[model samples]
Target: MRYEKGRKDASRSRIMEVATQRFRGDGIAASGLASIMSDAGLTNGAFYPHFPSKAALVRECVAAALEGQSGQIAQALASGGLATAVDAYLSAQHRDNPGTGCASAALLPEIAREQPETRQLYTERLMTLVRQVSAALPPHTSDPEAVAFGIFATLIGALQLARAVEGADLSDRILAAGADAARSMAQPRGGAGQEPAETGVTIAAKTERER
Candidate 1:
């Protein structure tokens, strides 16, 4: 019984993992259950036992994707501060890779059209991210929550715009510009005359292109 349960749990996890990649790479509407199941090395019939319906799977996948992104943001902020997190978020690598990138940027449009429950779940996850960003702001920032919201909005808009454009140079420029803007916003208001913070994210992004 223990082995069977363990095997079932593993299969369910694998299903969610593959579904996350597919839903992000191809829009949720474009990715069908049979294809997802086949990609997970399971037959179509195997999907029913794991997820009651396609929508159920989508809800689970959406939650998992957002949780994963939040975890990355928290780690980035912990290791390198807000500047590092912002820089990495608005970097070219993240822009080019939607499958493993921010869920909001990759699926906001489709999410808007989802059922109310799905939207509610997304909203909860989004607020979690906002709170994380808010807490990571500099100590002197007057209104951390509002500032965090603004920063988060900027990041999402910049990524969406960058991906919408056709040229590689233009995309890189957008990401760089966004990163600079985010870093500047993170600065304390009274420190306008102080030296800029040291953030190697932009430099790293440029180097990635050169390599």
Candidate 2:
């Protein structure tokens, strides 16, 4: 029985890893169960043994994707101030590596029409991200959550805009403007609308090529 349970756990993890990559690369709707199963080298029939339905898989993937991002976010927060963090986060690297990156940047629009369970799962993930960001901020503010919420909104919005444009120049501008915007948002109330903190973070300045 213990061996069976261990096998089930390993299978579930494999399913999650493959599904996450597929969902992020090609939006959730485009990535079907058969494809995910096939990619994981599991049969379609095996999907139901772990997840009851596609929505269940979506929920779990959403959770795992968000959890996966927590480490990057934490590193961003801990290593530098909010501006530097935004610099790293809004880079082309983060943009190009969608599969192993931010779920919000990759899949929110794809899951817009999902079921209630999926939506709830997304909401929880968003809340977790907000808390992580808020915890990284200066403690003088009365509403760290509010600040974090604003940052979250700005980053996702910027990514949406950047992803929409086709040109490399425009994409770079979008990321620069986004990092600037997020940096400004993270600033003190009296110092609003200023430029980014200019810690000279390399990731933010990396040229945007095909990836």
Candidate 3:
């Protein structure tokens, strides 16, 4: 019984691993169970025993993706501080690779239109990310949560815009602009040689208004 259970668990994990990549690489709505199962090297029949419904599978995939992203952010914070996290997140490499990048940037817009349960799960994970970034913020900040929120919003919006824009030059500009803004946020007020903070530009917002 134990061995059977272990194997079942392994199969379920493998399915999730494949599903995460597919869902991120392809939009969640476009990634079907049959495709995911085949990608996992399992029969379609194997899916139901692990996940009762497509929504269930989606929820799990979202959870797994967010957890993975959270770990990456946490590691960045621990190893190189907020500036490093900002540099890593707002780079061309991250912008060009949605599947291996941040889940919020890859899925938040679509997830916002999903069922309440899906949104709730996303909200929880987003807050977890907020807290992780918040803790790394300078101790004297007036409100760490708000600062974290602003930075989080900036990171996701920048990455999305970078990927959405038509020209490589514009996209790279968007990312570089975001990295500069984030670096400003991480610096202390009145710190030596630090220039005054400027209002950040968000190409996503401007592009949406134009559309």
Candidate 4:
């Protein structure tokens, strides 16, 4: 029954990796540990050593996905700016592959129904994400955090709606509309966050502490 530290760590990681995709592809309530363990190539008994319960696993998986997403958003914004990030997020590929895409888009409803601890973790992580986007907003922007929140809501809602509806045409239209709406949400009142549409929304200066 004894496993080395490294082996236990690897097994734990594998479990989370498989569970993340499973939870996103099939709702959390629908994904069983038996199946998740099977997918992770571990026996049912191995799971208990890594996590006390399915709720614990769910918390870990949610945190992992969001942490990865933070890097993705940073990369997208750095390479091409906000529009590119929005396009990538609202793309057909992302919509079709919920198993490996945004956690919020795939699991928002389930997260809302999770225990208070999990919900609190989500809120804290979400604020970090919002801040990342907010820091990139143009100078003199009015309430950039609120703007980022709106943009994230538009993107997450649009993706969820797109995946729910039947037909490529409607889904594509939804995605397109979502992108436009997210960009518009970023544009603050009184021309504070204004940027040339074609030029893309570049990052504003961040202080050394922020960096």
The model with the greatest lDDT is 4
Q: What TM-score would every model get versus the actual structure?
A: 0.87, 0.84, 0.86, 0.89
Where is model 1 more than 4 Å wrong at Cα? 1-3, 191-211
Expressed as tens digits, the lDDT of each residue in 146-166 for candidate 3 is 889999888889888899999
Poorest lDDT segment (10 consecutive residues) of candidate 1: 194-203
Error of 3 at 129 (Å): 0.9
Q: Considering lDDT, where higher is better, how would the candidates rank from best to worst? A: 4, 1, 3, 2
Worst 10 residues of 3 by lDDT: 195-204
Every candidate's CA RMSD: 6.0, 6.7, 6.5, 8.2
Candidate number with greatest TM-score? 4
lDDT of each: 0.87, 0.80, 0.84, 0.89
- State which candidate, 1 or 4, has the greater lDDT: 4
Task: Go through the candidates in order and give the clash count of each.
Answer: 0, 0, 0, 0
Task: Order the numbered candidates by TM-score, best leading.
Answer: 4, 1, 3, 2
Better of 2 and 4 by TM-score: 4
Instruction: Write candidate 4's Cα lDDT for 1-211 as tens digits.
Output: 6988999999999999999999999989999999999999999999998899999999989999999999999999999888788999999999999999999999998999999999999998999999999998877677899889998999999999999999999999999989987886665455446544331223322343368
lDDT (C-alpha) at residue 150 in model 4: 91
How high is the lDDT of residue 85 in model 1?
Answer: 95
True lDDT of residue 73, candidate 1: 90
